[model samples]
Target: MTPDLADGGAASAAPSPAAAERAARAPLMSVRNVTKVFGRDVVALRGMSLDVRQGDFISLLGPSGCGKSTALRLIAGLSNPTSGRIEWAGGGRTDADLGVVFQEPTLMPWATVAKNVWLPMRLRGKSFASCRADIEDALETVGLKGFEGAYPRELSGGMKMRVSIARAMVTRPKMILMDEPFAALDEITRFKLNNDLLAMRAKLNCTVIFVTHSVFESVFLSDRIVVMAARPGRVIHELNVDEPYPRAEIFRTSAEYAAQCRAASEALNEAMGGAGAGHE
Candidate 1:
């Protein structure tokens, strides 16, 4: 699953055995020399490549102009690369095998929570009645069991995000693409949602490709951080957390987390100096 090779990644130290082992596995999907340009002059991403193995939790970390969201969109098939390819191991697949969660809840305000979660399944030709149990379980999984009948307008921001995540999970997609899903929430709420996300990931046993600008959040939630640079955004470094799952508040305050964050911060600092400016 080793995603970044540019700059040989920014780790001052060696990866843990666990992380190395993980990197050696077969990739579920691979992006080779991907590039996306907004127009004639604006280059969003350039020659970006990465490998995503099954059950991996990867975070694309960088500054605002870095191609993190663009990368996610490519992975979700919501957009296409200017000149590159994304290949899945088992050959071609349908949209049903993928899920996406945007920064905003983006729920249908007119629909109830249950109905919102049922949208994906419905789009695939299943009726609400047919997937009622799956919908209920998805809601409960996100800690919104009793709010099924509630409308988006009636729910809090965190609850609305829960609905969004539930909808993504309901499809049991092999991989979920999340674009700063908790970025707008307050710190306390964001922390809770982070924990909830890890727990739900464990229960669902699905891969996640998350886009975020938060170093601490990425360290706590991701096993691998694909560091990117702007000005024709591209991978600059890749750091592996190597910590086992079920990360908790204790882990948050641990020395390991702080060290990883510092390393990532340093790599990010150098990239912000425009490391990608002269590169294609």
Candidate 2:
């Protein structure tokens, strides 16, 4: 059972450095010294490295143009790195093993929520009759059980986003990569989605790499935040959020949360300030 976050303790408790060392034991994917360049110049990323452990939620946090999305794209194998490597543990994992959620819902205007969610399964040659239960389960997981017949235009912004998420989850991928999926929503909706996201992640036990510019969101969601810098993007700091799962409102308002947010904010500021550059 998932631990109750409402009965909070030190949700942002500081773990020993060795804690990460322990988590690193079952590394799922590693992005090592990867770089990406466009045209003659336009370096999007440089020497970027990150380790994704199984069942961990990691956030790539940074300012705009910091290559957060670029990193996600590289991990999704949508693009090639200019240098370095991306390694997946126990190898031979294909695109079928991944779920991707972009900033926009990107739903089909002509399709129902169920159809949109069914797209992934259908692409894998799964007929509606074959995976109908899985699509419904994914929708229910995202709190949209009764809205399967609804069109994207008929749903609220938050609901549309939920459909997008439902689509991603339908495939039951080993890992999910999200690029600010909730950035477009209002605070209340975003908060609700954040909680639901934790619950879903707990239930799915899938590893996640989320990219966002919101420090608070990153602190609340991530086991570790990979803070990055721009102008040839690279990781500058890594801050661990030792908080427990099912993070509740009490945890959010707690002093521990504030402290973690401050630490992340400071790290982000320093990253934006260019603590170390001169690469690429």
For TM-score, the strongest prediction is 1
Model 2 steric clash pairs? none
For model 1, residues 70-189, the per-residue Cα lDDT tens digits are: 998888888888999989989965888888899999999999999999999999899889999999999999999999899999999999999999999999998999999999999999
lDDT by residue for model 2 (1-280), tens: 1132211223334455635553665778989999999887999999988888888788998888889999999999999999999999998578578999999999999999999999988887889989889998999999999998899999999999999988888888999999999999999999999999998998898999999999999988987788888887888777777766768877889887997887777677766773434323
Superpose all Cα atoms of candidate 1 onto the true structure and report the RMSD in Å to 1 decimal. Answer: 3.7
Query: After superposition on all CA atoms, what RMSD does each candidate show versus the true structure?
Result: 3.7, 6.2
- Which runs of model 1 end up more than 4 angstroms from their true locations? 1-17, 274-280
Per-candidate Cα lDDT values, in order, are 0.87, 0.84
lDDT of 1 at 226: 93
The window of 10 residues in a row where model 1 has the poorest summed lDDT is 1-10
Error (Å) of candidate 2 at residue 168 is: 0.7
